[model samples]
Structures are given as C-alpha cells and as structure tokens.
Target: MLDHLITHDDNLRMVPTDRNELAAAVGHLQEELRALPEGSDTARARVLTRWIGIAQLCLGHHDEARTSLRQSLELAVTIGNSRAVVATGLNLGDAHRYAGDVRGADALYRSALITARYHHPELMDFALQHTGKHLMECGDPAGARAHLQEALRLRIAKGDAELVKSTQAALERVELLISQADASATGHAVPGQWSRQWTAWLQSRITTRTPSRWAQDFPTVRYAVAGLTAHQRVHPCHLRDQSFPSALLTAMAEEAEKAVAADGYLHNGKWNAATLDAVSLFVGQVDLADVVSRSSGLAVEPPHTAVYIAYEEGQRLDFHLDEFGFGEANLILCLKHERPAELPRASTTVFLTADSYLECDLAAGDCIVFDGALTPHGRTPLSAGESVTLVCFGFRAREQDSRTVTHLPPVPSGRAALGRPESAPAPRCATLCGHAGN
Candidate 1:
C-alpha cells in the first residue's frame, strides 16, 4: 500500500499537472497512510506527509503546508533522512515567507543552507537561491548578490539550462540595483584628501566640445513650461545667465560644508548605497527655495534641503521614482564637481527606458526642477578619486497645501510610536545560525 501511494505521489510531480488533481492525489495518499496502523511505517508516512505539504503549498494554503512540512521534518530527523530533512526545511521556510514571517523564514533558510552543505549539493543550491532572494527583498543587496552569484555558478556547472536562465535574470536585477545605489550621491562628506594628480586626471577627462544650439538655448526654457508638463523636464543653462549670483552660490556651498562638518553623514537603510550628509538651512536662510518656487511656479514653501556627496569609487545611483511626500516639485542644484568642464549639460540623467537616458549639464548655481515623484533618474559612476556635490530641494504644488514643515518628518514624540510589530513564530531548528545536523 505504501509503495502504491508513493507511485501516485511521484506521478503528481509531472509538470502542467492540475491543482485539483494534485489535491485529490495528495488526499488519497494521505488516506492510505492513515489507514495503516499508527507509527507502523514512519519512513513512508514522512514521505507522504511531505508530498501533502507540497500540494498544500501549490494550492496557496500556507498554514496547512507549514504544519504538514513541520511534521515531515520531525519524522525525517527521527529516521536520519538528511536529504528529506533539508527538502522539508526549504518547503517550510517558503511557507513561512509566504505568510510574512520574515524572521522565521530567515532562520529556516539558514538552517537548510547549513544542512544541505553536508547532504546534497543540489539542496545547497536551492537554499542559496532562496536565501539570496529573501535578502534582496530585505534591503541587503550586497548580501543577496554574494549568495546568488555563487548559486548561479553552481547551477551552470550542473548544466541546468532552465535554472541557469532564471538565476541569470535574478542576478541582472541585482546588478542594476547595485548600479543605481552607486550612482546615488546622498550622505555627508567625510573629510578626506584627494591627491593633486587625482584632481588633474579628472580634469583631463572633461569634454571640451562646442555647445550645441539646443544647449545654448537651454537657459531660456523656463522650468514651469518644461518639466512640469510631463514626468520629467530638462532646462539647459540660459546663454545670457549661465550661473546664479556668486554670493548666493558661495553661501549655499559654505552652509553645505558646515552642515556636513557638524552633523556627519546619515545613512538611510532603505537604499544601503548612500548616506544623507547635509541639509540646507530652512526656507528663511536659503534663497534657493525662492528660486525653485519661481522657476517651477509651485507655491513651494521653504524646501527640504540636503547635500549629497559621492565618496566611493564606481558608485552609481539606481533609477527610481521618488515618493510623493518627498515633494511634487524637486530641484537639484549642481553645487560642486571635480571637473567644471565635464559637468553634465543637464541635471542627473533621466531614463525613458533601460537602454536610453537624458542628461543636462549645469554650472555651479545652475538648477533643474522636475516632478520629483514621477521622474526615474540616476547618475553614472564617478571616476576614481573624483567627487560631485549636489544640493537637493523638495517642494509641493501650492494647491496641495501640505502641513509638512520639514523634509524629514519628525517621528511622533510618544511611546506609542515606538512600538514594534509582533514577530512571526520562530523556526523549530535548534541551531539556525550554525552547522545543522553536522
């Protein structure tokens, strides 16, 4: 009877199988296992239970899947079936992850990874891929990249074309995210010295091409008429007034430097690539707010101002649209660059698609305004030993009438705001962090 039920379960593994058929098959196998005397055939019971769990998972019954998988895992351990234990561990972890039990999922994945390393190489590959996917979603791109890259290597060596293609697609997404993170120049400037030779090398790469007609006419194109109409807009430097008043530019730069010096750079965990270095003094102190308001034609209050400085080599910002709360109107002022001549002719480039992008070069004090929440923008990697500084300001359309007085909204000043959400139930594995069943 056990062997007949096992055959039925094996047949259900075929692809394009019907879910209803699978459920019925699982139910039939379950009934046969239960008909036998309790505890009479523990090994067969474990395998049957695991098959049932898999069927439950396919049907989106995560709770039932987890319960069945947990029982199968306990039996596998008792029977010293390391391979079954590892497989059950992975399935249980998936069930927990689907149920939003992140901590539980992490624990199970870690346990499976450790157990698979000693049991089967294929099990290890699956564990690595699943763990990497989890980390990628949890804002740990660096960690995810490491795991996925290794998993890809292993899968390729095994000559699994389908798995190779899926892993490659996942890896590409991770690489794109890393590129954007590198291009993002947010955070305070840590005091560091650049050799004169480094500065000279950067300057040598500056483009000295003659300005195009469009470039020359850029300044006259008002921001209100340009970027406000669509998701993004670019205004070239006006030929007549290519720069802001020298005093205002100097003051803004000085304030930026001072803020970095005083507060140090702040790291935002959401995009693990860059940090927030300095913020502009409020509306009353900086004239840039008025400039942005006038140019964008938004009844902008004093903007949330911040200075972003790129510190790492090969760092690039990822392409992403901003959130509405950041502002309806966003302005980026090019305050400083390593080579003035190579400063892009526009603000940071905005991408229309993965393969195409638009950029504008602006001199110090030259600013571009766009619908911050809608534009997908990012920067390229800075050359070795080179750095760029940008002052970012956020503004709302006047009619929105938001009461947000600061760019970084303050956390409510009470204990209620500090409460943590309840965590998921812990995994049953004894040592989730270290070697399991070793």
Candidate 2:
C-alpha cells in the first residue's frame, strides 16, 4: 500500500510502509506537481512537495527529503503561509537529524518552538510534538516527555480525538524510553508492575541483550549452566479439562484480547494499551496467583503482573537471564495466539536446558510456570497476520522468600498470596512459576 504523508493541524505524520511504495509515491507526486499548469497555485505544489519529502524520509532518502522540505518551505514563505512554514520546518529539522547534523536540527527545533509559542499559539502542540520527538532522538527522553505531555494536554483540550491519540502514542513511546533509561541506570527490569522498594523484580517485556558477536553467527540449541540454576520440582504441565479454571482463563483471555487489540497493553515499542477490564481482573483476583503457585510447585505469595503482545512480523524473544525479585518465578498465561501457516514450530515460548530445548505450544488459558530469570528462554517470531497475547505473573518460589525488602521498614507481600480457588481436589498444589520473564 502507498503510505500517506498527512498534515493535520499543520503537523506532519506518515503512515509507514516499505521503501518501494514510498519511492513510487514520490515519483507519482513529482509527476502530479509537474502536471500542474504554469502559474498554478503554489500552495497546492507546496503541499505535494512536502508530502514527497516525507515519503522520501520514510524511504531513508535523507538528502532528497531535506531538499524537498526546503523547497516546500520556500513555497510556504512565497505564499505567506506561516503555519505551513513552521510545519515544514519541523520536517526539515527531522531531515537534518537524519543527515547527522544535530546542531542544525536543534537550532531549527528551537526556532520553531519560539515562533509557535509567541505568534501561533494554536500551533503550539504541533511545534511541541515535533520538538519532543526530535529531543527523544537526541537522547533526551525526559525533556521529550515534558514537551509531549504538554502537547497531549493541548490536543486533549482541543477535543480532537485523533490528534489526541497521535500525541498520546508519541508520549507513550517516550515513556517507554524513559522507563528503559531507568532500567539501564538501575541494572534491573522496567518498573511498570515491579515496585521500587523491592530488591528483585521481573518485567513482561522480552530480553535486554548484549550479544556475543560470535554467538550471533552460530545456531546451537543446547546450552549449559554453571551457576545457580532452577531446580526442577514440578513437571511442566498443560492444565485443561477444567482442572486449571479453563472457564476463568477463557473469560480472562477475552479481556486480554481486548486489552491488546483495542487497548494497547504492550511494552517496548508496543506500549500504552488502556488498562481495561482485564487489568482490573488481574489487580483484584487472588485466586489466579494461587493456581499458578499450586501448578508450579512453588509456594508464592500474591504477585503483580504485566502483559506482552507481538503485533509485527518476525517478532521474537531471544534467550536471556532475568533480574531477581519480580522475575524469580513467573506464570506466563497464554491469552491468545495467531500462529502462521507457513512456519511450523514457530511463535511458541521456547526454553533451553543444558542438553535440550523445550517448546511450549500454548493455547488460550493454558499457562506454563517456570523460573524465568534462570532459564534462557524466548518466543519465536511471528509472520504476517500472526500475533500473540500473553500475561505474566511474577512471584517468589518460596512463601517466606516473597517479601518486599528495601531500606524502608519491611512490609508484607501484596494482596492475597497463594490462595487456591478450590477447583482442584488436592490440598497442596505444585510449585510457583520459577522462570520469571515472559
């Protein structure tokens, strides 16, 4: 499909697609501009040229985008369209950034901000959104957040739902980056569900990796562990036949599907789904954790959870270790999956042991409990039209080891730990989810 480069409220945005489509678009746009009669409206040509520049930018044709944007700006000035000038300037700044001229991008962003702030107050959000994105690209996510938050506030106040969403998405991207920065600083997982007071925690996102270059070239399945590994206490079980509350998992799966598909409950680049009904279910339901603890052979207290979903082609999780605390043990509930027809044995949660690899082809409401931090595990890639929604609960393997500890006063664990819902006839359940990561 041909990607659209649209201007809304004098701000530039693009629907991204492949380079061939964008290249075709630039060619078509150029032909259209050339077909305009001599002395035809410069304004029309200005818009076309700006679109061409954006298309080229998306195609990674930096010099071409910059040239087209500059030409568009000149036309805007010729037509005395100050709003277009400011808007086109933002694109030009992005071009400069792509061209590795950071100083030029910064200067243009500052100028655009000052002009919009004092002269065109209606365009404040446009200037701020563009500048915030530029700042984020320049390694200043905190600074970016302030600008994006204000832009979001303005867009919301203006009551344009689409504009509000666009800004909100941008803001959420920055928030994820900010969360990543915090994680890097602390040498821990991102703190969405994990508490700061806790010494250890697990996050639902995939691995944060520093790959050994040689290992990247090789393809070996078997791996060995020399350190403290997760001791196998409970066999990896697939609970069905209503033994694992399949009805509840089915209901929760519906809610989780909605959360991921409509609400956007993903981390990393895929973050900021609205926390809807399923989130409330996770926050309030204690029986869920109890079942996980019983099935996994770990006596865990109540646990907090985060979610994961993959929407793109070939999205996968590489093997890696998890942080302590929240990731010590985890129950990964497979809410949904869209396995591709072309790839058999793909897009499943696969874990590695010393001698062999274990692949869990999980369906909805089917969960696997394991030591996430200790096991080098990952989900394989998805093809086009493939997706997966997963919810993860983090807890400790032992009941007494589940307490949250820090410099402050020691506090008990979270709400309702390890309470079975009386579904199974047995008194003692299995272990907790030892594998902590998603």
lDDT winner: 2
Off by over 4 Å in 1: 1-17, 172-438
160: Cα error in model 2, Å:
2.5
Query: Per-residue CA lDDT of candidate 2, range 393-431, in tens?
Result: 665445443332222212124323322234522221122
My TM-score estimates for the predictions, one after another, are 0.38, 0.42
User: How far does residue 306 in candidate 1 sit from its true spot (Å)?
Assistant: 41
Q: State the weakest 10-residue window (summed lDDT) of model 1.
A: 428-437
> Candidate 2, residue 300: CA error in Å?
48
State model 1's lDDT.
0.52
lDDT of 1 by residue, 171-197 (tens): 666666654654344231110111122
In model 1, state the lDDT of residue 114.
77
- In model 2, which runs have C-alpha deviations exceeding 4 angstroms? 1-15, 37-40, 184-438
